[model samples]
Target: MLNYIWSAIVLLSVVCSIFLGKGENLSAAIVDSGAQTVQLLLTLAGVITLWSGIMKIAEESGLTAIFAKIFSPLLRPLFPNLDKESDAFGSITMNITANLLGLGNTATPLGLKAMHELNELNGSSDTASDEMIVFVVMNTASLQLLPTMLGSLRQTYGSNAPFEILVPVWLSSACALSVALMIAVGLNKRKRRL
Candidate 1:
């Protein structure tokens, strides 16, 4: 579907350029944009790689374990079915820690593992469990401490201070998490009542 959409968009753009007598400009734009995209990706890859190594070091140093310990209490209520020291809990902790540091690329695999573990806890049900929904919400609205991806984008784009949005990002993510938690709890309770 996305492929079709992008193809349609490119076809439209080519048609428009031809009718507008700007085919040459469009040709130049395509090459230039493609090069720029590659350059930006390379820079972003460097930033992501650096952060991934840092996260690995943190994991080796038991830093993620510390985060798991801290988050365990909060997770208990949200995921009552899960054992306190379950593998799911460990994955969740590692995933959230990576997210907090803003290494989204690093967090993806952890999150997938966490979800798989969570589904096992759900007994492989067809429908998503409330805990699964809550976990998804938490991951999606993940509060970032570092905003590494955004900072990297800003840096690549030549921003003077890439990480200046740290405070705002934190506040927004906190608010999102709070609201999502409230909604998830409310909906779960409502489902129970019905």
Candidate 2:
């Protein structure tokens, strides 16, 4: 469905360009679009590599483990079904840590793994458990200490201070995350009442 929509949009744009006697401009636009995509991918790759390497070092130095331990209490209520020392907890912590650092590309695999583990604990069912829904909400609204992706985009666009958005990002993310968690908890309670 999305593919068809994109195809229609491109076709319409080309027709409009032809009618405007600017058909030649379409080729330039397409080339520029492709170039921009390639540049974005390269930038993403570089950022992911740098963060992933730092994460690996942190793991080797036991920093990741320390963080997992520190956050275990908070994570317990969110993932009550999982054992406190489970690998899922570790993966979830690492994933959240990566997200807070704004290394989303690096966090994706770990998040998937955490979800997979959570599903396994649920006997691999098609339906989502309460914990799974809560996890989704938490991940979606995870607080960010560093808005690396946004900073990268700002830098790419030649912003004078790419990292200047830090304080606002931190405050907004914290509020959003708090609200998301509260909503999830309320829904869970309402489900129990039903």
TM-scores, each model vs. reference: 0.90, 0.90
Candidate 2, clashing residue pairs?
none
- What candidate 1 gets wrong by more than 4 Å, as runs, is 1-4
Off by over 4 Å in 2: none
Which lDDT values do the candidates have, in the order given?
A: 0.87, 0.87
| Cα lDDT, model 2, residue 19 | 99
Deviation (Å) of 1 in candidate 1: 5.0
Cα-lDDT of candidate 1: 0.87
Q: Write the residue-wise lDDT of candidate 1 on 1-194 in tens digits.
A: 99999999999999999999999999999999999999988988888788778777877887877877899888888988787678788888888888888888888878888899889988988988888898888898888998988888998789999999988999998999899888998898899799
Instruction: Give the deviation of candidate 1 from the true structure as CA RMSD.
Output: 1.9
